[model samples]
Target: MSITRRGFLGASLAAAMDGWQPAAAAGARVTLDQLQPGVYVARAHNAEVARANAGEVVPTLVHVTGAGVLVVDPGPQAAWGGALLGAIRALTPQPVRWVVNTHAHPENVLANAALARLRPRPVFLASAATAALMRQRCADCLARLQAQLGRAAMRGTTIVLPEPALQAGGWLHTGATAWQVQVHDNAHSASDTVLYAPQLRLLCAGGLAYQERVPEMQEASLQGWRQALRQLAALPADTVVATAPGTPAQTLVPTLAYLDALASGIGAALAAGCDASHAIDAVAAAPFRRWRHFHARHPLNVQRAWRQLEDLWMQGEPLA
Candidate 1:
């Protein structure tokens, strides 16, 4: 099925409204200098990239509270995490009292050691599944990355699991606010959480939500992801933040559409073929062709979605 010109324009418009500003066209590069007084934004770009790789620039933010400071998602390694910690210090002297991991991603959880060095160690928080994934898989995750990226580059970075895991079905309190954090399992990752700050009206979602690009997934549950967004829409948050090209203030639209499009494409493929590879290739080649660069990654998002859909179909589960 061909995407009509009108459909393409609609997708393009949605992408624009939701933070898919073209890097070349917008000529907008979010830097630390442009941050506001109460906000601190840090992007960790990979040290290896010659032209500055986007992987290294995972922007983490710190919001200053009257009582103390609240941090959202620490970077994957010490270099990025340490840089983020330093940026927060420059913004304020107040000890960070609360640390929230938007989801269980290595890039977001590898900097707890440096953050703990503060006078008062901040309490770490994540969704129940995220906490389990962190505790069970964090160290091995870092080790694997070190093996792949080389230990020298991954120096001073260890996976430190957060205490007090967020349980399913409700909000969790951190600092002065009862943050409406939801536990969304098997969506973007094994377990992803979306944080909704009523006071700030900000939604800090990890990989479950991304900005200006396709949603990267290792293990994705399409139905769960769609439902999670529906749940998030009911929250009081007006602004959505994620690990992306810019700060949390700018909403992420591409990630949402990426998931929706993947689900749609996969459903069509399953009806046409019995093999998962065929489904994956067809989906990746069709509606997702424009996102070819993203397809280079191993076990690409479509493949992951295909696997998840296979499990669901095998169990006779209903599709979204």
Candidate 2:
């Protein structure tokens, strides 16, 4: 069955009723007192860059283990990472045993160095493919950021590369809890990984799923992204925390709708002989605009969709 926007919203509402609030809402002002025992999200509150933006809010997670605490995707910048660690310390004195990077986005994985300052030197984990993608693509991404945001806004920007990369079916064990980290390469970005705790049926989906906004689809693999979400839907992840904070912890449908809309909208535009810019405008003016994050991400999503459609059509394949 096709997942629609309404269906996605309904899923989000259901998750809310199950005790998923904006974990990052508290991170807006100060480091939290303690991340509760259960799954809790950390939201980056950037007054200048992300205040007006609802989705740019980065998602980090804290999980308690009998051995020590595990931290996931420490915000983007050093300061944000420090604040996250501060928040974690407020929760437990147990050293951080692991620092997991969901992907290579500066706003997502650049805090490994700071996190390594811990007593145990947390093992920074990422997919081998993602680690390579960072080395090859990060310089270009940073250059683009410099061009777009200019030098002033690009201060303190560092590209982090992950070590001890995971292969397929990679597993990490901490205390009584175990995490299964898998690489769903060539999806949202060049490479992506999501953390799942099967025992709890909880998912830490980095960029694979976003909420409360449209996706920033630059460098996105539209078809691959769709396939990945399909695989995710097959999981029993009852609680989902996305890369964007305040996103309901278990809504799989919204991300599905956004991906499906982009694919279908691209197909419709192409069949109508619309140009890339025209397709972007048309999609944004119609179906895409209904999304809360549409204003910020529709243009990029359209660009990616058009490219993907163009490639597929040229190869004599129908858009899926």
Best model number under lDDT: 2
lDDT string for model 2 (1-320, tens) is: 11111101123222322422222322322233123354566654422234243212565777768687777877644434544555555555667787887787765665554565455567877887777767777778666645654443344446666775676687878778878877887788878888778897777788888665676677788888888888877887667777553323334677777788777877887888877867765553464466676666677677768887888977978787
Off by over 4 Å in 2: 1-36, 45-56, 137-160, 245-250, 269-278, 281-290
- Give the TM-score of each candidate: 0.75, 0.77
CA error at residue 288 for candidate 2, angstroms: 4.4
Query: How many pairs of residues collide in model 1?
Result: 7
| Per-residue lDDT of candidate 1, residues 1-320 (tens digit) | 11111111123222322422121321112234324446555544423222234225456666776678787776655544444544554555666788887676665777665565545567888776678777888878787766665555466665667875666657766557666767777666777777667776667776656544455564666778777766665566656656553333333445555666667777777767668767655553444445435546423776777887777767877655
RMSD of 1: 12.0
After superposition, the stretches of candidate 1 with alpha carbons farther than 4 Å from their true spots are 1-37, 44-55, 169-176, 234-236, 245-252, 272-292, 297-299, 314-316
